[model samples]
Target chain A: MDSLDDYQIPYGLMAEFDTPADAMHAAEQVRDAGFTRWDVHTPYPVHGMDDAMGLGNSKVGWFTFCCGLCGFFGGMLMIWYMNAYDYGIPVGGKPNFSPFASFPVAYEMTILSGAFGSLFGMLFLNKLPRLHHPLLKNMRFADVTHDKFFVVIEADDPKYEEEETRALLKKAGSKHIELVNE
Target chain B: MANHSVPSSVKIAPPPEELERPALVENNRSLGWISDTVAGVIENKTPGWWKLTFGISLLVSLGLPIGLVYLISTGVGVWGLNHPVAWGWAIVNFVWWIGIGHAGTLISAILFLLRQKWRTSINRASEAMTIFAVMCAGIFPAVHVGRIWFDWWLFPLPNANSIWPQFRSPLLWDVFAVSTYFTVSVLFWYMGLIPDLATMRDRFRKVAGKVVKPAAKMRNKLAQFLYGLFSLGWTGSNRHWRNYEKAYLLLAGLSTPLVLSVHSIVSFDFAVSQLPGWHTTIFPPYFVAGAVFGGFAMVMTLMIPLVSLYKGLDEIVTIRHLEVMSKVILVTGSIVGYAYGMEFFIAYYGGNPYELYAFKNRAFGDMNWSYWWMIGCNVLAPQFFWFKWCRTTPWFIWVVCGFVNIGMWMERFVIVVTSLHNDFMPGNWGYYSPSWVDMITYFGTFGFFMTLFLLFCRFLPLIAISEVKGVTPQADPHHPLGGAKH
Candidate 1:
């Protein structure tokens, strides 16, 4: 492979903020600036930051809802298929397909599938378990888990301009700015 | 702390003392401070007491598998189970352990959905407690199935014999209920751990800079890699948090029903039966209440010592948290007491001689000592918490909670044994007493539970670092709310 330094690969520029407010303000400015591929990172969830980033409500609930419905019916069907349709049992002289008797298992399965759906949905939507990100290459970036908050404007954003983005971040109260590598 | 100032047009801030909510975590520590406190417990040297406790627990934990192996080799006859009392201490301990597991879900999921911020400080440890308790609970049923090797018969797989689990049996419902409870609990606990693992990963990297030993440096690297892998490369990105929060809420929503249903189904194991004492409709709610009561007692039992053992946890797991938990114990304990009273009242009111005799037998028969102990421990012990001193004093509350824990176990004993030992036919009636194998297996489960918990305390973040930080006013930016512009 060619020498790494010779290649032109602009990953992004990261700006650090001392507080969540500065990060939130910077995020709003970045959002209004029409950057679609940018994000804010903080040690914990910053209330109202979702609005600051102009992100929509998460679709994870819908996934869980659908899975729960499927599980409810699926569990009931399985019980009926096994007990009533497939092999008829005359134990207790009660009907094999009683919904009252089957409700507990059905309820349990609904929760099981719903929980799995939500967890997988969240991971899927967030594209998690990536195990690597360009931002992680910078040691100081790890501070996002501690005290620091950051806003990263990806170079892939169509509106990105090296000088202008740097100036924009500085104006938004960023304490430290770095040119992150790909 | 982040900005608390608000705009003039909104409601004026009240005096600080009159604030709507008391601080969940005291001392007004920073986000980094909270992370450092939790991570330091893991990174620091193992305390001498921790070593001593873990050593004893480890030796005890070995007995669990030993007892199981012995039971399997010698057959279920090794247990005290026989004749009228076929479900001995195994089922009693199973129901007890499963019941004890409920408080974790109640704290993590139900409280999370309810927005009880105080839960964050203790939820991580309690959730670990839940997982371990369930593991102990699982061993009972696995061994209870006479031919242990053929336990797969519980599962509905395509088989040559073509036999299926009895769908109408509450025991079958338990197979599904318990497995799902374990799976969802683990997922919820792991999901909550992701951000904290990232925190741990970062802390390990920082420690690597100061370590002089090459071996220590390599260990740090390994630890960092493990944390990073489990954290799923989390960066606290807003998009990720948005989705993570939603998914967490949905899981909490799903688990609430599960917590209620699991114990109800457990109660159904008896309530569905034809026996007079076991056939009561009140068993479902009564069992759930007793479970929560026992669970909170166990949490208190675990938390009191743990909060004192680790430095800085006093501020995080404040005395007020214990007070609130005590209040819950009091409430649930009363419900259990009321259920006990109603069982007698209804038996008399209905004029059913069999039901009346069963109730009378419980309070005045051969096992009356066990029944009285259950009432004393579960019902009377928690009544002390009504006094603020008893609730506020850690040692006093701990001792009381210990009784509550013992009482809950005995309550299970009374429910399982008392109900089964006496039936309609006086000829078939018999007394049940635990054998050595039964006693050893029960004690071994404690070793198993404590061993897992001690490991959790030493390795994982005992407090949910990210969740605790999220609750503090500092994380808000505009803390009291109106100052920061959107």
Candidate 2:
């Protein structure tokens, strides 16, 4: 199913917590309980969610760095080929092949590259400019931007079972969960 | 509905006009010191140092007319121009002074866009620096060519007489670039000044009786008249700030690129040429980094003390502001150092003989002392920012900033002089130093720069009183206990 909640959860399983510590404790219990397809969102950043979620570090910065490199070289080649090689003028006895002279233009390229790289890289990797999204459609999910925290266990989880998942949620002290739909 | 929905009939009292003059703080004999002291300082007209600087600068500005008359009468032969150095002191000073203007814009526009709050107090003075510094810079190239009459040839026109300006020429590109820079800079400076001018106008209106103090009633009256002319009598309503702020953003958007291009094209003048030292790809950012480095150093030199002298502004100007500015110095200085490293690596790795020799000569050649001094001021002095003592202490920070300015100037001198004096051919190598006229004119620009800045400090609200008030805890201080101003 395209929707995350379309799957299910175990009996009385509640993803619950008052403190970050409690959240982490319940998160470990949830994971250990074979709740494989779930996500945890928090009020403030928690320290070890990546480990808890088994997620890897992001590749966004590396993409930006590559873009910056492209800019630098692009700038260098433009000035060099145009000035020194293509239409060489020997002003003040400077050699036609002066790489030293090609620098300033190239430096601008580096900045442009880095800036553009960061911008486009961020947009591309985040899959932005989508005008509409399935998640943002949910009014409850909207409140996620504010003071609320949520832990979502999908119907697709290996331990997914509707009745058991509801009981499991209740047992774990989740304050509430009204079903979110497409 | 009438009582609850319509709101209370009780008039919510308006807050006091200033921090020291708050209704709560006033009427107390002890707190009277704050307002009495501030009014006292503001009341005392421009001080001795200001008049002295103004007198000197006015005298030096007269030098421009005198020098122009001399140049116009005698022709290009009056000044020393020889075979190797085609672009002499005039161009050199233009680049140097324009480079000096860099820090002001960076402090105001770049830092403001980045949301640095402390820039409030010093940004006014630094923006004024940008205007005055750019004015001095704009003058140089105007007179550089022999026939000042035919200097318009540099413009890019598609006319029949000859042909298009060589876009290939960095000099031509510089004409496009620097003029754009000056135009955008003036616009940016003026846009920022409008809101402040309105504030001054309001203050003058409200306190017309007390205005006889700082200036003669005449100058204060002149300020009021000028503000009316410029602002069209802006009435400090929300609508005015909204429109003014929108215009400010447009100016900022225009300036960001102009700042980058102006220095980049300047770097092109050397980097496009095939001179050994000048030709390297590192030059553009290196020069920009160096330009900003020098500019901030100049800003630091003036702003540190000036902020302390102005009343109530110290709260806004704050130690944190200088500390942050010092960090920028450290970061840009490091970028310059990194550029130097890349130059060294590329020089050796590429195995170009002329390039290697040019760089080597700059460091180890006869003028090596200048080169070492450059490294000491630019590279070493900035490293001090790593220490809290260096960044936190105002006296120490000022001294180090002075060194950074010296270092940056030396960097420009080393770049211009070493590259020109010695080139690819050994026989063509020669020495160049500023003559008395060159030295005086250069110092005269400083006199001009300081003269404008000093007058700005004295006559204008040195710290933007309105803007500083906007940022203070009285405006938007983080309040855990309450929702609004305490």
Per-prediction DockQ comes to 0.61, 0.02
Top-TM-score candidate index? 1
Steric collisions counted per model: 0, 25
TM-score of each: 0.97, 0.65
Q: Which ten residues in a row are the worst by lDDT in model 1 chain B?
A: B1-10
Worst 10 residues of 1 chain A by lDDT: A1-10
Taking the tens digit of each residue's C-alpha lDDT, what string does model 1 give over B1-486? 013334566775445776558777787787788988889899899999999999999898888888888998989898888889998899999999999999999999999988888999999999999999999999999989889888888888867788777888889999999999999999999999999999998888766779889998898989999998999999999999999999988999999989999999899999988888899999999999999999999999999999998899999999999999999999999999999999999999989899898889999999999899999999899999899999899999999999998899999899888888898889989999888888888999999899899999988999999999888877877764322444
Look at candidate 1 and give me any clashing residue pairs. Answer: none
In angstroms and one decimal each, the interface RMSD of every candidate reads: 3.2, 16.9
Model 1 bad stretches (over 4 Å): A1-3, B1-16, B480-486
Model 2: number of backbone collisions: 25
lDDT of 1 by residue, A41-62 (tens): 9888888888888888999998
